[model samples]
Target: DGVEDDAMIQHAQVFGKPRTPDGRVLERALSARSSKSGKAYREVVKLIIRPPRAEYDVKKLGPTPFTYVRRFRGGKQTVMRTEFAVVNQRQDVELKCSQWKPVGAHLHELPCVLYLHGNASCRLEALQVLKVVLELGCTLCCVDMAGSGLSEGEFVSLGHFEKFDAEAVLHELRSGGRSNGKVALWGRSMGAATALMCTAKLDPLVSCVIADSAFASLPMLVHDLLDEKVGSVLVDACVEINQCVGCS
Candidate 1:
């Protein structure tokens, strides 16, 4: 009975069960499985932590709705399409983006800065960033990663598949002609990993990558999460589940 109790507690802790992402409590847990459960146990653990429904429209955030489409695909026959409605939009001939230029901007092409947000987040989350671009005399384009915000997806794979999603945005910005033949990528949390992974693949893709609050390694983060919490029996299962979810 105690073992079952521990497993339930561990599962809830990792998956943000009982309480929702917004800090609301629902109080929930999956069926407990012992370390002896083998492969079946891992599968069950993996199945329990589904990504929350984080879909949101930027149009609803403000009155003036400016829409731009960013499309990509992943998994099996899954299409992730996003339309961002910003408080401001500058459809430069260089690319299809929500570009906000500095005050007194007379040029069509400006230094473009792409913003990437974290998990359970959307492009609208970059409100502060958009403002900074105005001060820097630059244009900002926020990206909505798959399975989050307006992007189409049932779940998020952390940074694993999101790497591809980030790269796609890189090419997307260059669809027409580049202002100066370079772009800067700035991302937070999971979005940071996506940004770093993209830079790793193609160093010249972006002028520079700014990653905020990104983990050094995913496994270490998982281990730390379970420290002093879950029992040894449930630790392996929980970590495996986390790896699957994170690595996607």
Candidate 2:
């Protein structure tokens, strides 16, 4: 009994029990594994909403005057940096943008392909496929999503709120005459989910959508992670506590 009590104390310290709004203990039957499951659920929620900000040298990717000479097009394309502000849920989000376009090409002339980076990543991730995009004869544009990289935001709602950011960027591009009204989306992971969500609403403006490694459902993904952490028996309880805490 003494050893059991000590184990319980250790579990309480490591994985706190779920509580009600008034701080009343809710589930006394919670084992150490169950407590761990609840903790994992909350941690996953925190991670999803506030992922670690990815920082890197923008100069290494390319700033203004960084030109790429096309082999067949017989001209040099340059990368240009731009900034725009988007207001979502009354939060002012300033997006840092970069455009790679052929020299002397008018913005309204070439089709634009907006690249959306994954979670905890910045616009510089587009550098991986920059050459392929350039070869496709389409203008490539990349932006730092809100709550990631240089964008201003306190939280990230994954595809829920990020889709709006993508929409706003597209709107700015078209309305401001920065784009030719022809746009394609290329997104990876979280960005892929955002692209799919945004495309559903703005199918008319989006010429194509290329989603890479997007989750089928966010909730299912969280559930699977929790199951892996603690097992199926505690998954429901953890999910319930997470929902109650408004993390879901």
Candidate 3:
């Protein structure tokens, strides 16, 4: 048993180490595959690659964009819970959000669509559906997640951190005594994944979901997005790099 593991470790090391190119030596390392490991070592090899930064300016629509609205409060999130484990205690404030209603719209009666923006997007994206929502005689709501739009954060955690954000928003909606539990979700790209993830976590409250262009997997998304810029080999490298080192 040890002999086989020893062989896998040896093979992994061959690719893990920098081989001086004698042409033949470099070829062997690239072709190298560890027994049972199946390029999980390749996951490690992806670290050196630099990922692109996701950037965009928060929308500056104007002062007091809507009339019917409620402000948010600030507080640390210590007992923050998820479907899995409770994370370590950290200072966190509830996500800032706004709920808009037509003059005639009444709570526990008017239907609403919670809009979740895509990666690198802000709550202003709700405007994209505002017109249709009004036409259908429903209200619109959206929130700013940490690190995107007007939310506070140094970096985006993709959906890992956002799944909780979605949950918090739903809790806010239901607890406010505003929604009659008749709510639907609309998300695009990263938002789409968040919508699906949230619904999987809470399907009863989510009457419907509209997700556009959601990626099957984050790593495959990285590979496909980079495939045109780099060939398949470089794409694999970038994918493995992103996989090993969690990047967006």
Choose 1 or 2, whichever is better by TM-score.
2
Q: Give the per-residue lDDT digits (tens) of candidate 1, residues 115-220.
A: 8888777777676675455445456667666556665544455676566666656565555443344678888988888788778865566888889988777656
**Candidate 3 local lDDT, 1-248, one digit each (tens):** 44543443343333332333343433443453343433543432322221123344433432233442222222211111011111111326446565665554465676768888877777777767765665565667777665566555533445545666777777656666556767888888878888888788645578799998876687677656555654456445434323332333
Reference-based TM-score of each model: 0.61, 0.73, 0.60
Misplaced by over 4 Å in model 2 are 1-41, 69-86, 230-248
Model 2 steric clash pairs: none
lDDT of the candidates, in the order given: 0.54, 0.69, 0.55
Which candidate number would show the highest lDDT if scored against the true structure?
2
TM-score of model number 3: 0.60
> Residue 192's C-alpha lDDT in candidate 2?
94
Clash totals, every prediction: 3, 0, 1
Sort every candidate by lDDT, greatest first: 2, 3, 1
Cα lDDT tens digits, model 2, 96-131, are: 777777667788888889999998888889989887
Global Cα RMSD, each model: 13.7, 7.9, 12.5
lDDT of 3: 0.55
For candidate 1, the 10 contiguous residues with the lowest summed lDDT are 87-96
